[model samples]
Target: MPSPSPILLAPMEGLLDFVLRDVLTRIGGVDRCVSEFIRITGTVLPDRVFLRYVPELLNGSRTPAGTPVRPQLLGSDAACLADNAAALARLQPEGVDLNFGCPANIVNRHGGGAALLDTPEALFDIVRAVRAAVPAHLPVSAKMRLGVRDASLALENARALAEAGACELVVHARTKTDGYRPPAYWELIAAIREAVAIPVVANGEIWTVADAQRCRELSGCQALMLGRGAVADPGLAWAIRAADGQAVSGAVGWTELLPQLDAFWRIISHHFPGRQRVGRLKQWLNLLRRRHPEAEAAFMEIRTLTDPAAVDAWMARQRA
Candidate 1:
């Protein structure tokens, strides 16, 4: 590993919110975390949106636990993105990251996220403009896929991004067509790393500490950005940091997991009280489904409970 370790929390839009970020960073090993993409279409998003996600900017550019939290932006208009970058600079974040990798239908259709990759010329112009807007001390980085459809354009796209003055790039190593499927082919990240001048962070399919190690060795990039892997096991970062032969944390059974799960809902509940709270819980449950069979049952129970207390009770009963 590279000194303190090189794991970063991926900039997952809805999933990597403020509280979730807090939880993961506290896990001992994660060095950096990027807030969900702040969509800047032209209008400057309110300060609350920035502080709500990037509270770290308030205290020197690093998250409360000391790991840096870079704010990410997603949009198509170069001028708008440049303006947004300039505006956010006043906050003095450690860095700003460009989101050229989001595959969401809404973002793609608007030509804001991954859709820009389809037009490499536009992508080049946007990155160059944003680089010009941000201060030299603050790094401008990017996260991208191999291509929108197949992995054909990965090398060329990576070269264009690097040549455009981006400080570094994180290659997710899969085409947009792969979505979040298996076999992320981290080896492709090695190819991009060799092709670029700046540091390349390897992302995708890193579920365990061994996986991270293998990714680094196979991709020749020790820097890793965790997406779903971090979501499934929030303690992963700390484990990776310890760098021991032992697994960092133990698996919680349904019995022991209920209280922690219930507590998380409470935190989310505060932000989204009532219907707002319920919606957030549902979204989190969707991620839990991949790791917990009872997540489906808990989600079904919570879907109609409406009452937060009742939802907690139902979730508790899901214990194995």
Candidate 2:
């Protein structure tokens, strides 16, 4: 093929924060990373909040490893979003991403995230406003689900975002109601790709290289964004890239990943408290276990441990 194509790290709230983004993107093959959703409420949030969400904005909008970080905004009010986008633009992000795809009940109840799918006009207006507010050089992208309850508005929603000047869009290939059920409906992305002229990135249900190839063929989307799968298999992007092109024999096995795990623990413990670090490490370890037998064995060793120091010691032993 013409090249493996660009892979983006999805903005998964709570899970893929700056720390995770820093660790994961460092593995390579990921072109860019979007920040955890910056919750825009009734008014424009201050710069500190944006900085808190995307610390990389201060570092040339890049991870320590050099992957560009795009800040994602989530909310319903067009004016509030636009105003916040303007403030974010001042901070010089690579781009501003709008989140219309989050399925969290808390987000929807607060008139943010997938709730906007119910009112396509509001989604359009929000995009239009943010697009107008940000500098012309900066890109304005959007992420959305197929629809709220069904695929009924998929085309309309895609068209609305494209018409409102979303230079690129990422479709999660499922309705808000699907809530990550089996079968990500990759075919739905094809209709979205056809509906909009801007680049349509296919997301959801891509857990392996084979799945990536199938998603590319099925969605007809050159760009693919990875979420949980990337977390579970840190070397997945490299493996996928190698499968299509030059061989990348980097960090595939669990033993090979121990150093990375230790690096993550040392980096995160500097900021997160012992209990929070314990929880975060386990959260990642749980996801990691899905792909690596080593992670499963490691999790079993630390599953009941509530102290970060104990967890650190366990990881040190693994390294030894």
What are the RMSDs of all candidates, in order?
A: 3.5, 1.7
lDDT of each: 0.78, 0.90
Global local distance difference test of model 2? 0.90
- Give all TM-scores, in the order shown: 0.84, 0.97
Looking at model 1, the pairs that clash are: 272-277
Compared to the true structure, candidate 1 yields what TM-score?
0.84
Model 1 per-residue lDDT tens digits across residues 220-299: 99788888887776656666665654355654444444655666676776776776677777877777676678777777
Query: Residue by residue across 206-305, what tens digits does model 2's lDDT show?
Result: 8999999999999998788999999999888888888778567675778667877888999889988889898888999999998988788888888899
